[model samples]
Target: METSKRLEQALKKLYTAFHNNELNPECCKQCAVGNILDNTDSWKHLSEYHGALKLNYVGKVHQSFGRKFNGYSPLELLQIEAVFLKACGYELPLHHKNKKPKNPTNKDILFSGLSETVRFLCDLDGIPNVMAYTKLFEFEENEKPKYEFSVTD
Candidate 1:
């Protein structure tokens, strides 16, 4: 499928951020996965009806990554989540986490597997790589404000 211009722009921004090592873990709450699930009607319906646990799992995965690796960018978080979903056998359009599966896997096992998957995806090259599926927008990095204190005698 042809990617939307908006999505392309978002992917570019995400890639740039990843390259610059400027991702912020604090923004994970508002990351691309959360935003897409929250704003898109189709994703919202899927999460509400069939993928609530899966959605929750994604959050756990994010938290896991955050705890393991500090300073993850929002794009990086989304990329990891996307890789996790795909690894768990979810496809696009629906993008719903498998509600019921022939094989039931343990959450801990799944988390470990998906974490590895994210690490692998993050190491890929170029824009059209595996982790760029979501195609979300660029987030401006939060800069720490500088304060100068002067003493007069």
Candidate 2:
């Protein structure tokens, strides 16, 4: 699919922030939420028909989490962010790398944050439940799933 220029810019910013260890959780969370909502039917309709007015709705979504947006608590919003990130192929933190390091590194902070976010989001409804799919496929097959590592991961 062809990504919108705005979305591409947002992704580049996110990647730079991640690599530089300069990620602002709040801003990244808002951007992720915005990107996710922008892809939804309702938001798409608004964007297509109303143009700049759609930004108002995005802002509302960003603010709504404080008051439990779409019945999701503030904590749940954070989880949704993590799930979204993972779905987009962001790597969560690992406890060990090649069974050598038993502890998490400074960079692991990013993973830990994402991991916590995904854990919470999975507890809610209407969101894509990746765990169910990942687990089912993992156990149903004898061989581990093959993944192509990329610089982003």
Candidate 3:
């Protein structure tokens, strides 16, 4: 399926980070948005809190100036991070006291976050969910899957 250039690039980085065990919802430099932005924490300045969607002074200025980091506006970046963190079982605002997964770095945990983030990204670009597996559920003649998918786990 065709994906926007920016979405493709973002997916590539997210895939690499997930496989390399670099994704961490608690770390701004290694979280979903961080990986999309090449591991830079400068995006944190876009908001007052780690998981907030509200843009601060600098962020508003950049938005007014039409600035984009890796093809995402400042607000868009914050929203992406928020979605990822929430899907990863994080309590928004990202406090230590907030409930979170037992193993935040686990592959399963990260996958959930990445999947939701990708969905949100696709929605922003008006495209299908690139990570969807529904195609494997399609039936041919109401008897078998149109596409074959195997699972061993």
Lowest-scoring 10 consecutive residues by lDDT in candidate 1? 143-152
lDDT (0 to 1) per candidate: 0.35, 0.36, 0.84
Q: What is the RMSD, in Å, between candidate 2 and the native fold over all Cα?
A: 14.1
**Count of clashes, each model:** 1, 2, 0
True-vs-predicted CA distance for residue 9, candidate 2, Å? 18
Error of model 2, residue 57, in angstroms:
14
Model 3 clashing residue pairs (backbone): none
Cα lDDT tens digits for candidate 2, 1-153 = 333343334334433434434443333323344333332233322122211223245445554645533444334434455454443334432112312222222334444443444344443433443332222112112332233212221
| Model 3 whole-model lDDT (C-alpha atoms) | 0.84
The C-alpha stretches of model 3 lying farther than 4 A from their native spots are 132-153
Tens-place lDDT digits, model 1, residues 4-94: 3433333444333333333222133222333323322222222222223343444454555653222333344345545544455445322
lDDT of 3 by residue, 33-129 (tens): 9999999999999999999989999999999999999999999999999999999998988888988999999766877888888889999999888
Error of 1 at 126 (Å): 13
* Candidates ranked by TM-score: 3, 2, 1
After superposing candidate 1 on the true structure, give the runs of residues whose Cα lies further than 4 Å from its correct spot: 1-69, 93-112, 121-153
Residues forming the 10-long window of minimal summed lDDT in candidate 2: 132-141
